[model samples]
Target chain A: MQLTDYEKQMLGGENGPAVARAMDLLVRYGEALGAERLVETRNVAGAFNASTPSIRSMAEDGFDRVYSELNLDSDDVVDIPHMAVPTCQLITGIDIENHALQGADPGLVDMQKDGERFFGQRGINMMCTCTPYQVGNVPVRGEHLAWMESSAVIYANSVLGARTNVEGKESTGAAGLTGRIPYWGLHLPENRLADRLIDVQVPVEDMAGWGVLGYFTGLQVEEAQPALNGISATPTLWELKHFGAAAASSGGVEIYHIPGVTPEAPTLEAAFGGNPMPDPIVFGERERVATWERLQSAEDRSVDFIMLGCPHNSIEQMSRVAELLEGRKVHADVALWVHTPRALAEVSKRSGYTDIIREAGGVVMSDTCPAISRRLPKGVRVIATDSAKQAHYLPAIAGVDGWFGSLEHCIDAAITGKWRGGP
Target chain B: MPDGQSTSKIVMRGRGVVPGKARAEALVTRQTISGWGGINEREGSVIELRHELRGQSFAGKVLVFPGAKGSSGWSAYFHMCRLNGTAPAAMIFTRMTTKMALGAVVTRVPAITDLDGDPFEMIETGDLVEVDADEGIVTITKHET
Candidate 1:
């Protein structure tokens, strides 16, 4: 890969060991992806860190070694003083703030807190979330970013019109330290053109319908760029969030285009980039129902846990949840958890949505979700969630049966502790 | 079981992403494997509930699949496989994607992709596969039943 003089200088160890090591990893990673040259970014939209059992084990080796191995993929221990670009930590392996609520061991909680402190000392914002855009890290249209988290990547690319690939933890770390990424894939405008055209014949009025559409579309065009048409109504931000999250979870779609809805797709012709649109794949109600049926795993109605957010709920979504549970209470047999960004949690608290949720016996959590943390109340036999992404993952990650539905259906399940069929 | 002489070696060519050589039994699947929580890091087993090879362990085998699915966090989980000493002996992706590329890099195994022929049609589970990443050739010796 071609590198600038400054990059070469860094590669030559002129700028110090940490930057040099980070540059080396970036160059190799670019080469691995067949990227020709590195691109510079002025507005780096922060990064999401990946925490695993192996990464957690690095505590014994100390923070320097941990940073070196996890981020730089180097064995050499080097001190990283600060990120070259602004950075924020992503959802971790366990909920550090409320481990007891998740039924986690004390040692696991200590490990998470220690990791947080180490990252915080290095200038990484500790607002761990998949939806960093909700927490004031919003990137503008056409901005270049190095972000991880599948949902965030799709949202940045499709909704925000920012350019970013679904970056891995290592590459994002390198970008945080070097403010550079390989200029290939979704970073290039030519690759962003829609290859598959999807016509939404089904009426997608709610978040669940949009999720089903996205799930169906993603399965149809696996790894291919898709553009949607024939959608009469404009979707809300929350609906788009569900659409992108579900599509990205079920398929390998890094970017998508919704004509007149998402930025860069002002019209169907523009979404196709002057090329002839491919034959449209019809997403009808039958397909949507089938997709929804596939997500349901529970044979019985009993639900032990009800989780509200997957990509971390926005403040608006939290407000809606609060409104739904206003005068109700979560069933004694059900443990209802509402996941959101820490910043949004603060806003929800100020708005009294947190108190309302608390009064209803639901815990409003931040910095983590069951999908990333891989934690749930012990012996949770069945789980209900409004997120298609969460429903697709919880069975495998948490070893529980899943019931996927709308927010109202999930709230109803939380109240009655029973999933009385579909909404 | 058939005699050793009955086993025939078939050589297929592809591009090598990581440089190494290993011969192991193959665990093939057409479904793309999810990166996050898809595999058990400790045991190196496919834990994706609906995956065809659900309970099968990929440890010490050649993992043949259509490439990675879901999150970019895929590399981190596979990286843990390396640290835990439970990674597959080698990997063969039918189609290369960014996530799978990073996974191959972090796993540091003999990995190949963009084959001359479809690897899914050519390889099967239990086949003794030898990967020469340096030469970009995979020698498959089918198990004689």
Candidate 2:
């Protein structure tokens, strides 16, 4: 890999120890990917998922230390969130909140606190939550990038067509400091192509259906991008969020083209950029049903837990849920949770969605999800949700009788405290 | 470079991410790792829940998978693996998740995505394999005593 003069000077400690240290980390990152050289990143997006006290303390301390050591400019504002959110549920252990706050096994609260400290010192704008794209930081196509999530990476690559390597937490910190990344993969046009093809002939109407289809297509496509055709439904930006999230979770897709949506391809041939699709797969009812089955547990019984917001709930999502539960109440036996960033939580509070959801017997929490905090009420024998991505992972995270259905089914379970299958 | 090994064998057909070449042992995962707590940046080991390959090192292996499971943090976990010297030699996405793709790109490990067969069915833990991310081809050579 070639290094520029500035890079060499930084690596050689000609730029001082702090720049050298920061460059040194980036250089390792560059070498790991065999990047020929590093390119400067612009409009960089920062994200971190530290959920342990010790690690969080280190991260928080490191951010401050690195900032002061380098004397970074304030204009290089960071986009880190003030707290952490649960990314998964605990399979073992008791007392969800207690486990997250004061467990023998390091808890997530400390991680949140430490992250807050680090970004706080730098005056980094920390918008805690995985789905930063939905919040206005959405990068335009062909933008150089850095982010710290699988779904976001996939979304950035596939949905947004922005170039970013699925960077780690420290990578974001280093990139944030140095403002550089090894340009390759998704950044390159050659890497984003329709290596495979899918003819979507199903009637995918809602987010749930989109989630199921995405999971199915990802399962079928696995590691390749597919040029989709015959998509009867023109998914809204909101629906595409679920599709992109599920697609990335089910497979590793850097880019995908919906006939009318996205830029690279206006037509199937254009999506492939004139390249022939070697294999064309058809997705229909059976495929969707199979994917639904794979994402859900076969068990049929009363459900005790229901969760939403895998990518962190947006204010609009909260408002929608609020509308859904205006006159309803969550099941007495079921515990429902909605994950969001504290910043958005404040907005939800002012918007009255918080009160409505809370009145409906669900808690609107921040800095954690059932997955990351390992905080799910004990003995949740059955769990149901509207997210296919969440349903797919919940079994491994928490041993609940899990089921994946529409929002109605999830809300119904929340209302009746029983497992109800969807049609 | 091993004797009697074919370099262009099709391992599995899932999604494809990076375009390069790498060879090493295969790390198979059933429950994908979470990006947040799934990887220890300092240690570079899989630290997520119920993962069959949990606590296992990712040093120079032809990592195989159905795909990443949770959190946008998935890409970061793999990125940490590269930074801390525990990176996989090559990665085969049995399926591609956005995080996995970004992780592959950030780590710059030779990653071959979009396999021709089910990697989970064909490749098992401890299998010797070679991946060509450029051609989207993965070759597995059965190790003989």
Candidate 3:
């Protein structure tokens, strides 16, 4: 891999020991990916908190030890420095406001608080949500970014027309300190072209339809980029967010194109970028029903828990949830949690949506979700969610059955404590 | 019945990823593994529901698989596996991705990929294997039936 003089200087420890270690990890990671060079990136989002139980013992020593071993992949502990580029924190394992409801230990909450203070002082913005683009870090088209979170990576690459592969925690850590990442995968212009094509037979309407279509796309495309055709409706940020998140969860899908819907492809002819588009795989009603059925892991009708957001809801989605629960009371057996970003959570509270939902026996959560934290209401045996990503993961992660449906079905389940959803 | 199986030795060549050497029993799976919610690093076990390797521990064994899937938390979770002393003895995979490469780098285990022969066909669970990632070579000793 080629390195500039400035990079060489950083590797030589001219900036500091932590920067040197960060550069070394970048080199090692870059070489492993067959990356020919390092790309400069001022936009970075990474997973850097000492939130989980696995990091509990490491936190006892110092945050530096945790950063040295976990972030830099280095054995030596070095004095950390301020980030050389713009960086923000992603979703962590614990929600500070609802840790008790999440069954999280108080000590772990303190550990995460200490971690925030330590990294926050060094200029790492605590955005603390997966949807950084939804907040304020929207990168321009063709811009290079080093970001973690598979859902956000797919969104940036596909919807925003920005370029980034699915970077990991360690690589993002190095990029935060040195403003560099491996120039491979989606960074190159030629690699972003779509090769797999799928024709949508049914109306890809609403978040639920987009979620099912996204799930099917992941299974078919796997790691490859896909192009969608035969769309009848234009999707907003909500549908696309759920679509990307669902695709990333079922398989390792980084980027996909919807031809007219996505930014890069204005037409079907332009989507392939001169690459040969494969024979169209029809995603008819049969496929949609099968996809929806696969997401349903629950056999029983009783739903004790209802989780509304996976990629974290937008303000509109929060309002929609509030509007649905305005006159109803949550069933005595059901516990409901609606998640949004902290920045948006404030708006939800101020907008009266939070109070309405809370009065109806639902909690508005921020900063984390159940799947990420591996926590739920005590003894949750059956779960229902409107998110395809969350429904696919919560059952597997929490050892409980799950039901996937529309937002109305999820709200009905929360109010009646019954599973009324079907394919 | 235990004596009825063939004990054949097979040798294959691939690219060295992590640059080290390790020898251990091979635990093979064709399914791609996820790191975040799909695994329990503290216990070194696959926890993803409906995964074929669910409840199986890769600790002190050669983990042969397709590659990584799901979250960008792949490397961090595998890195925690190394710190907890629950990582696989060696990593021999078939596919390459940013997630797989950085994961192997941070796990700091002997890793090899892109072999000339199909690793899934030639390797199976409980097979004694040697991974010399520095030289990009793997030797498999088939186990008893």
Q: List per-candidate RMSD values in Å.
A: 2.0, 7.7, 1.8
Best by TM-score: 3
Can you give the lDDT of residue A220 in candidate 1? 89
Ranking by TM-score: 3, 1, 2
Candidate 1 per-residue lDDT over residues A1-423, each given as its tens digit: 999999999888887898888898888778767889988764443333434455556766677777777777777889876787777777766665677887776766676777678777777888788888888878889888888888888999999999988878777777878889888888898888889999888789898888888788778888889999988999988888899988998888989998988888999999999999888888886777888898888887899999998889989999999999998999999999999988888899999999999999999998889887777877899999888889888899878899999888999999999997573
After aligning candidate 2 to the native by TM-score, how far in Å is the CA of A224 from where it should be?
A: 1.2
Task: Count backbone overlaps in model 2.
Answer: 67
- Residue pairs in candidate 3 whose N, alpha carbon or C atoms collide under 3 angstroms: none
lDDT of 3 by residue, A178-293 (tens): 99999999999889888889999889888988899989988888887888998878899989999999889888899988878888899887889876779998899999999999
Best by lDDT, which number?
3
Per-residue lDDT of model 2, residues B89-112, tens digit only: 887765444455556666767776
The sequence of per-residue lDDT tens digits that candidate 2 reaches over residues A311-366 is: 67667777888888888988788888776666678899999999999889888876
For every candidate, what share of the true interface contacts is present? 0.64, 0.27, 0.89
- Measured against the true structure, the TM-scores of the candidates, in listed sequence, are 0.96, 0.74, 0.98
Q: What is model 2's DockQ versus the real complex? A: 0.20
Q: What is the lDDT of residue A343 in candidate 3?
A: 95
In angstroms, how far off is A253's CA in candidate 3?
0.5
> What's model 1's TM-score?
0.96
Flag the better candidate by DockQ, 1 or 2.
1
What is the Cα-based lDDT of residue A162 in candidate 1? 92
Question: 1 or 3, which is superior by lDDT?
Answer: 3
TM-score of chain B of 3: 0.95
